[model samples]
Target: YEVNQNSGNENENGNGNRNDEATIHKSGNRRTLHTTRGCTNKEFLNCQPLNLKGTEGAVGLAHWFEKMEFVIHFSNCVVECQVMYATYTLLGDELTWWNSHVRTVGHEIAYEMTWKSLMKMMTEASCSRSKIKKLEIELWNLTVKARPKMLQKAMELANSLMDQKVRAYVARQADNKRRMDNNPKDNYVHPGRDNILTVTLSRKEQRKLLRVEPWT
Candidate 1:
């Protein structure tokens, strides 16, 4: 009996290999290129590769992966290389700082893997809107965890955002107050029992108070 070479599982050229690599010629040399670029550098830094060994190392790797996944998902975009590098570099230094201080506090050396810690790492970099939204979502999710430490960290972040918003609001309110103060009234009235009280200050006086251009 003759063997049929054109089996359905075989390639057109009759190669029985299931995994086929693509070949490209560059500089007159044949080279094989993988289908995907694999994990990004940020991903590698954040997560351990599949080949990583040992349970302890694996745990640390998993921690990094979780923290980074939170950050990336919160930010809603692949962090730019420069920002990622800077943030991770800061995190490395912060880890060193925490380790150095841990001994003095009588606490064992613990990894500084917190959202606030990560935010501190990225302080020098401005996060995008998507990232901020993502962070908020992550914080909301963590609220259900109900751990005191996580809740405290979330509160701290919330307070920081609130403080910034309050400052902006106050500044806008002051601007509006100043605008109103500088506005000139065409008519004036005096206060009585059930009457209105309107004090017409001179343009110069108003300008002195509001620090705005006086109406001529």
Candidate 2:
């Protein structure tokens, strides 16, 4: 009976040791598993989450980050290259970078990021338009102090949004030209009138003209 008890005790200890080993192995695997190659400093800054509102917002941002990580990991070569280009645009100087690199990967992503950043900066200003203007002036002053050339490009982007009238006018002109180009030929009339005009009408026009009755 004592021998049987000892065997049972040894069996229990063996099982416990196996379980511990398994646990350690599982933890090691988790630690070693990385979703993607590490992000660069600029990429990290570009992909950083905004200040979220609540737990729900935080979760949403976490999910977005995970999705971005997955893309970085498993996306095709083209998509990965695009993600890199988008990262550069968000954190780097657009004009200088644009001049340096001809390929714009994920252009839509860069556009959306640029717009969102500008909107956030605009919203942080005081409520009044005058206050917002003053804030922009102060921002420009600080930017110029740091690096004048960089600030010039930044100001150009800001001013592009500020000059809405020019954009509106250019859009209207383009729209008008497009409409004229697309106008249907079937809707228009021939220039000269059949009866009232001094020039003689063609046979087809004369026949149609004859069919019309004068007012009694």
Candidate 3:
């Protein structure tokens, strides 16, 4: 009977040891899971996008553009790349990036207009050669972040817009020069001005343009 009691005690001890091993294993897994969650949270903070509120008003759109300058310069998310492409389409569709206030009752209305005003301003202000150089450095750092696949695409979009703005600016400058040369003595000013920047209609147009996937 003493031997039988000893054998039972040994088996009970073995079972208790197994349970303890399992508990430790579970705790280790929990720690690993917690560590993973912490890393993911950091990624979220690093890659999170800013919400742009100014679509119609120049002040609002200006703020939105300011947010984008930081975001695009440092963001590597595929979705964020699409955000810039989305902006291009937004400016293209309206052909007028500024608010109606830009076309005050005093200014002469023209037959056809385009997005040069606002596009030129943004490209000149934030996308200047100096700023572009700084952005290039930031973009390189961003490419090493998560979702690296879209980094090149984001750069492409920005470059394309900059190219477009440059072409438009040159054309406008030439036109201005031609006008001045034609009437050196008139001291004439053009009836309607160019270069306004504003976006309206919320993000609906941007979403629709991106949906078309014109860049693809």
- Per-residue C-alpha lDDT of model 1 across residues 54-83, encoded as one tens digit per residue: 122334545544555554454332333323
Q: Write the per-residue lDDT of candidate 2 for residues 1-216, one digit (tens) a residue.
A: 122222344223534532111111135324221112344535544554332222223344345445445444443223325344333423223234433333454455444444234334323321343465569999989877879777788999889877987889999999987887798664576665535454444544765878764358
Report the C-alpha displacement of residue 118, candidate 1, in angstroms.
53
Can you tell me which runs of candidate 1 are displaced by over 4 Å?
1-146, 186-216
For all predictions, the C-alpha RMSD in Å is: 25.6, 23.7, 35.8
TM-score per candidate, chains pooled: 0.20, 0.15, 0.20
Candidate 1 vs. true structure, TM-score? 0.20
Reference-based lDDT, residue 65, model 3:
58
Query: Distance from true position, residue 191, model 2, in Å?
Result: 92
Model 3 / residue 48 / CA error / Å:
45
TM-score of 3: 0.20
> How would you order the candidates by TM-score, starting with the best?
3, 1, 2
Off-target runs (Cα >4 Å) in candidate 2 are 1-56, 78-81, 84-216
The alpha-carbon deviation from the true structure for residue 59 of candidate 2, after best TM-score superposition, in angstroms, is 1.7
Clashing pairs in 2: none
Q: In each prediction, how many residue pairs overlap at the backbone (N, C-alpha, C within less than 3 A)?
A: 2, 0, 6
